[model samples]
Each structure stands twice: as structure tokens, then as C-alpha cells.
Target: MSAIASSTSPQPSSSPGTTRNTNVTILLACLGVFASYLPVVGVAVALPVIQQALDASTAGLQWVTDAFILPTAALLLTCGMLGELYGRKKVYLAGLTLFCAGSLVCLTAPGIVLVCVGQALAGVGAAALLPSTLALISHVCPDRRKRARAIALWTASLGLGLTLGPVVNGVIVEHLSWRWIFLPSLVIGVMIVVVGMAFLKESRASRDPHLDVPGQLLAIVAITGLVYGVIEGGSAGWASPAVIAAFLVAGAAFVAFVVVELRSPCPMLDMRLFGSRAFSGAAFVMTVTLFAQVGLVFALSEYFGLVHHASTLDIGIRLLALNGFTVLLGPLVGRLMNRTGPGLLLVTGLVISGIGALCVCFFHASTDTGTAALVIAVLGVGIALAMAPITTIAMNSLPRRLAGTAGAANSALRQIGSALGPAVFGAVLTDRTLATLPAHLAESGLNPADQGQVGGVVAHVGIQAGAFLRLDTPTATERALSAYGASFTDALHMCALVSGIGMLVAAAVALVLIGVRNRSPHDATPEPATA
Candidate 1:
């Protein structure tokens, strides 16, 4: 084992030329994060249009987002080490290059499969970009206060990308093809690559970085298997052989991962970090909170496009209520963080988020725009409140020596939750809606043959089949529409119950495990960050 990197201040002489270089590096680093997060929510917002255009299934739609997130999550820990061994600037630009390539692929894709492939490529790029950007900032601004400020701006840029995803894609898809969603990302990515290559200085650590290849592969399999099982189970059947196999593989791989980490001399994640109650509690809170936030974004997008038949731009505007508060409440959230305990803030936020999700249970097909926005705003507020405290809880609970791996693991878990959010929520929505759709159709006063015909169309077209439910005689479109809406609303209720109750349960767990006290030992100093 080697001594860590951040022992002393590495701030360069405060000259005008050096200052200019540092500012430019920070700008590029911020842009890298912005680009990484841009498509995360954007792709989810575009799910409805992609489904309709490609005639995709529920599982296929889940993959469209998960493919990007899965690789990003699985490879995150490894990528940082790679950058440390090689060079941060090179890895940073490599990440943008791949992201641009993914965007190009998406721009030209003719099928859902191709789109997923493109997203997977972008996911790999994101994995590389996130950590290298942080390393660049750490390298350029070595003074603790300045680095902190740079990281804050970097964090804000990430939130901006997430917040704006819906609006950007909404505007683009409304005017052109859904594929145009990638055009802006593509152009920015290419520009960054070109500029960064010219001006971005290279930096690397002094040692050959440790590689945990086996643990990395196992972690990937575990997450991919779990998500695939959930998504495919709904589309196929719960008892299907493939689903059974995926679950079994995931379970086995997870166990193997724990064992490998415990025994490895140079583990990717320090398993002992979870021994702290605060660390465990904070990790759980982040995972569950993000699960609700990202999952709800997906559900609402589908609701607006399929249930209410809203335009792309309108759907984006309505969804804005969900994330707009995060940006608006930024200063407030920061002030509250200083005045309150992370555990307490997390608990309060979860309770408020639970109430917000519970409110979503009341929404129906005819629910007006204003009412829906109000409920989403409450949920968004809770998310914003709960989000930042997670970092405090996790980082403070462990020794400074564990900072890099601890941060990496905490971040990886959050991404895992993100990947699963759409997979699990979309699956639940599809399962309940399809299972009870027949009963609603039967109650529509339509005869058996006509009922079966409409059912077939629903099967072929999936949730957005409301537009194709016309009948020749004796059957009215209103009856079919009523049946479909009722079924979908019932399904949405199940998702709401899960999200609402899940948050409350997570709050209880946090209360049991976390404390308000300062938990870190003062004996060890923080090692220098070695991206």
C-alpha cells in the first residue's frame, strides 16, 4: 500500500497566466460533468416518443436508459484508477470522444437496439469523465478552499444538466425527430474534445494503480443481472426460465463480490467502510432517494404522453415542476445543511417525500395540469432537501484514508439505484396495467369478440394504443378509453404505493442507524486525491 496523494497544499504560484489556466480547466471539467448527466434524464423523457417510433416493448424501453447507466455505474471505480495510472486529461478527452461517438450513433440509429448500444457506449464514457474531471480540478486548484469552490460549481453544473434534460429534449423532439435529442450533446462533446486536446494539461499519479479486475466484472454482472431480471420478468413472465436464470446469476455474483472484496489485498471498495452506522445509513438514504426521484420522472413522462396525450414540449414543461425546485431551493438547502444535522434533515426530507409520493396516488387520467404540478413540486422539494446531506453523512463517518474509495462506492451505489429505478418502476407499471386491463375492457360493455380485438391492438401498440382503439359499430371509443385509463391509473397507484412506502421505510432505517455526532477520527489526515 502507498501513502495517499493529498498530504500538502499543491497550489501553484498565484500568477495571472496560472490563474487563467486554472479557470479554463475548471470550465472544461464542469462541462464534462454537464455533458455526462445531460442524457440521463433526457433519455428518460424521450422514452415515449422512442417507443412509438420504433414499436418497442416495455423491456426494450427500460434498456434504452439502463444501458447507459449500467456501464457508467459498473465501471466508475475502475476508471478513476485508470486515469491515475495513465493521465487525467487523456482519460477526460477519451471519455468525451466516446460520448460523442455514442451521440452520433444515436443520431443515426434506425432501431431501439442500436440506440441502446449507443447509450451503453456513452455510459462507458460517463464512467471515465466523472472522476477525471474531479481530478483535473484537484490538480489545478490544490488549496482546499478553492478546490471546494470548484467542486461546488461542478456539482451545480451536474444538477443543471439533469434539470434541463427534459426541456432540451422536449423542445427538440417537439420540433424535429426524437433523435435530435443527441445533436446538442454531440456538438458540445466534439467541441470540448477539440478544445481540451489543445489546452488541457496531462496529470498522473506516481504509482501504478491497483486493478481489481475480478471484483469489477462480478459487480457488473450482479447489477446487470438484477435489472435485466426485473425488466424481462414483466415483459416475459415471472416464472420464465430466462428470468429465473438472471436472478440466480445476480444472487450468486453478489455473494461472490462480497467475498472477493473481503479477501482482496487491493480492493476497489473498502468493505470495512460499511462498518460505520452513519456510512451504511447514508448509503441507503442516497440509493432509495434517487430511486424515487428518477423513477417518478419516468412514470410522469409516460403518463403525460400516453395517458393525457400531451405534446412533447408540454410534457417537458409539466415535468419541470419536479426538478425546478432543486435549482430554486439551492441556496436555501445549503443554509439548512449548515444549521441542521444530516440525519435529521434526511429524515425530515424522506417524510416530506413520502407525503409527496402519497399525493401522487390521487392523480388520474383526467387530473388537471395545475394539480399535478403542485404534487410534483412537493416531491421535488423533499428531494432537494435530502440530496446534499447524503455527502456529509457518508464522507464524515469514515477516516480520511478511505475518502477516495468511499466516495467512489457511495457514488456507484447511487448510480445502481438510478439504473434500477426505471427498470423496477416501469416493470411494475406494465405488469399491473396489463394484468387488469382485460377486466376493465370486459366492464366497458363491449362484447367478447370486440374486446379481444382491442386487446390485441393494446398488445401490439402497448400503453400508447389509445389513439388506435377505434371500432366500426355498437362499440364506442370512449368505452375503450375509459377502460384503458382505469387500468393505467390502478397500475400507477401501485408504483406510488411502492415509492411512498419505500421512502418512509428508508427514513426509519436511517433513524435507527445514523447519528448527529461528528464520527471521524482526528488521527489520520486526508490523503491527496489521486484521480
Candidate 2:
């Protein structure tokens, strides 16, 4: 971390009149935020319906999800700086309006292309809401415990949104149309904007610098290019010319982004934060943990829908095992943080998530529903344990004034992990499916064309179907099942290895960098400062 990268002074205290204003402002802020984030998880349940409705190709299916995340990843730092410069309240309100506008786009989109554009717009809204919400929270809840609780509540909203998104989408898509997903948010957004107009006070940042225009542009281009390349790489072979070109451009852009940030007078993101042992360590762990969680979600969605032939509603109910645990455990873990701090919770959470990954790895093609549910539930527990602690560590490490930017950056990191995890893991699974299929085809005595078809089927169905296959097979059906069983197990093994490696890396960093609790807000007296 650059030495100069240390936190600026804390914001001034709220006067009596300001206190009441802050509370109402925060309430509106929270509601707007919740409405925005609600879409993140909500779309998962609608994936199948959208796939069918749009006649989406296999590769196109991945893009549907990636489109929403890529823009959010690309523009996070830029939007944060916007809030820090103009005022968080203004930035936040603009984000809400954009989100609702994006929702409108999604609601009326006639094709996947338009829908994707809408998702990208929502990503912009995310970039805006994510950071500004944390900033406002810091301003509103000054007490450490109160702030921590509020942070926990805010974080929980993310998990809650993900969990409920599916349930709501499932019911809506099942009964009506997919457009309803975006429609509800528009209504809620209108209310938030109305309430916000009356109560929210504009908060100018306590410190500001000349906006680093060149650096901001480079960072956005680099991240956007990188994510686009990765997602495109997954669908197109990584070696494809277009994919390779994206990677090259992304690499060059990233290099430029780094150079610009290092020299910029007013860098959007403090590049020095990466040098801090604590920040870097926490950020890495948080990123990797999110990768596993989201990757698992992508994997399971395929497993349930394609293999188990589960309905969206059923998938929602089934995934409740995972999301349910997350919803239940988040608050309890937050309360625990008050006494134990976050390090232990992080380690424990990762361990559980690792274990959960293991459970998923061992799943048999014929694994009972009860058993599958248990495995998913365990993974959820791990996520619940890990998410809050990592967030708290990241937030508390910073000066209170930068809390919003830190929160937004943290949120962005998690999404980056979410984006990369599924892409990489999906690649691994795809490669393994291709590699293992030739042998399975030969073993089953199928000719080349039949073999290719089998490989394609296995890619989609093996995760669920292979789990139940018996190894000793005399019949043709038995033989095919055995092959699938082996392939699925191999894929699961790969997922386990990835999860284990990520967890071990996180655990090592946390053990070394995280020390005894040292800093507290009470350490200094409040003072008014200028932006």
C-alpha cells in the first residue's frame, strides 16, 4: 500500500437537525438499494424461461448472465469517484433513476440484445448504489456497534435479494411473463425517489482531488475488456482469434490503467490499498470465496434444470437449502462479530464452504434429493459465515469517510469473483467433458457421430445423472451410466480442487496479515472537514 494511501480524516458529526434528516435519508437509501440489488439473484430463476422464450443458444445463455455483471465490474471505480466528488446523495439518486430506467428497458425489451443492454444499465445503477449506500450509512450511523449492525443489515440485503430473487421470479415467470422481474423494481424505485427528495441531505466528501480522467477511462476499458474477453472465451474457444484479441486488448488496457493510476493526481481508486497486507489479504479471500459461491450457483442451475429436469419453482425451493442458510446465519454472524471480531468467523466460514464444495464434488448421479439439498445447504452455510466478516474487515480498516467507496469497491470485488469463478469453472468442466467423452464413446462402442452427441448430452446432464450410476455395468444402459458417473465425478473433483485451493490461499493470508484488533472509531475526536 502506498504510504500516502492511508485514510483521510473522518467526516464531521451530525448536528441534532441533521441527525433526523440522516435517518430518513438512510431509510430511503436502503429501500432504493434493496430494489436495485433485488435483480441480481432474481434473474437466476428466470434463466430457463428466458432461454426458452428467446431460443437462446448455449453460449448465448452464459452471456445473458454475464451481461449484467460485466458493466458493474467495469464501471465501479468510476462511479465511486463520481460520488466522492459531486456528493454521494446526488450520485445515489442518479443511480436509482438509472436503475429504474434500466428496469424499464428490461421490461420492454423485445429481444435478448435489448435485455442485455438493460442489464448493463442496471449494472450502472449498481455501481452507483453500492458505494453511495455505504457512504450514507457511515454518515447516518456513527456509533461503531450501530454502524456495524447497519452494515450487516445492508450486506444481508444482498443475500436476501439473491435468495428472494429466485422465489419471486419463479412465481412471476411461472404464472405470467418474465418482464415482471424488472417492472416491480420500477414501482419501488419511484417510491424511493419520492421519499428521498424530501429527506436526504447532500453530503460533500471531506477531501477531494482533481478528477483523474485518463486513469478512470483506462480502468473501465480494461476491466470491461477483461470481463468481455473471459465471458466470450468461455463460449468461443479461448484460442479463437476474437477471444485472444480481447485478452490482448484487456492486458494492454490494464497495463495502461495501472500506469495512469500510479501517476494520477486524483486516482479514482487508491492503488495503494492493494499494498496493505490487511486490505489485500481480505480482498483476496473475499474474492475467492465469492467465486466458489457463484460458480456453485451456475453449476447447480444447470444440474437441476437440465439433469434433474426440475422446474424453476422447484429449483428455487431446492436452492433454498443454500440461500435459506445464508439468510438465517447472516445476522447471527454479524452479532458474533461484536465480541469475536471477524478473523475467526472468516476462517470458520471458508472451512465450511470448502467442506460444502467437497460434498458437492462427491455427489453421485443418483444422489437422493434429500442428500443434494443437504450439500447445497452446507455450501450456503459456508457463504453466510464468510461474507459478513470479510466485509466488516474491509470496511472497518478504512477511515469512516471512505466507507462508501470501500464498500462499493468491496462489492465490486465480490462481483468480479462471481463473474470469474463460473467462467473458469465452466471452462474446466467443458474441457473435462470433451476429454472424457471420446473414451466413454469408445467404451460404449458408439460410432463417431453418436459419440459426439453423447458428449454433448453428457456436458449438460452428467452432473446430475452420473451421480447415481453403478460402476459395474453389464447392460448398455448401465455402461453409459457408468461413463457419465465417472465424468461427473471428475468434474466435481475439479470443482473441489478449485474451491480447496482458493480457501487454503485465503486462510493462509488471513492467518498472516490479520492481527489483533487495533483500530476503532473512538480513537479520535470528531472534527469538521472539507472535501
- The CA lDDT of each predicted structure is 0.74, 0.71
Per model, state how many residue pairs clash.
3, 10
lDDT of each residue in 298-383, candidate 2, tens digit only: 67665666446678888878887666666677678768777676777777778887788777777755667899988887778877
Worst 10 residues of 1 by lDDT: 8-17
Tell me, by lDDT, which candidate is best. 1
Worst 10 residues of 2 by lDDT: 521-530
Q: Write the per-residue lDDT of candidate 1 for residues 1-531, one digit (tens) a residue.
A: 133343322223212238878899989998988888888888776787899999998778878987887788877777766666567778899989999999899899999999999999998998888878867776676443354445556655767788888789888777788999998889999989998998887776544356778887888798778767766775676789999999999999999998987777666665666666777887888788778777777777777777788876788788776666656665565555545655676788788888999898999879999999999888977776666566546655543333334445556767877766766787777778888889999998987887888788877776667544778763567788778888888888888888998888888887888744323211122332243
Estimate the lDDT of model 1.
0.74
Instruction: List runs of model 2 lying over 4 Å from the truth.
Output: 1-29, 55-61, 439-453, 456-486, 516-531
- CA deviation > 4 Å runs, candidate 1: 1-29, 44-62, 84-90, 109-114, 133-155, 194-208, 396-404, 438-461, 473-475, 516-531
Could you estimate the TM-score for every candidate?
A: 0.84, 0.87
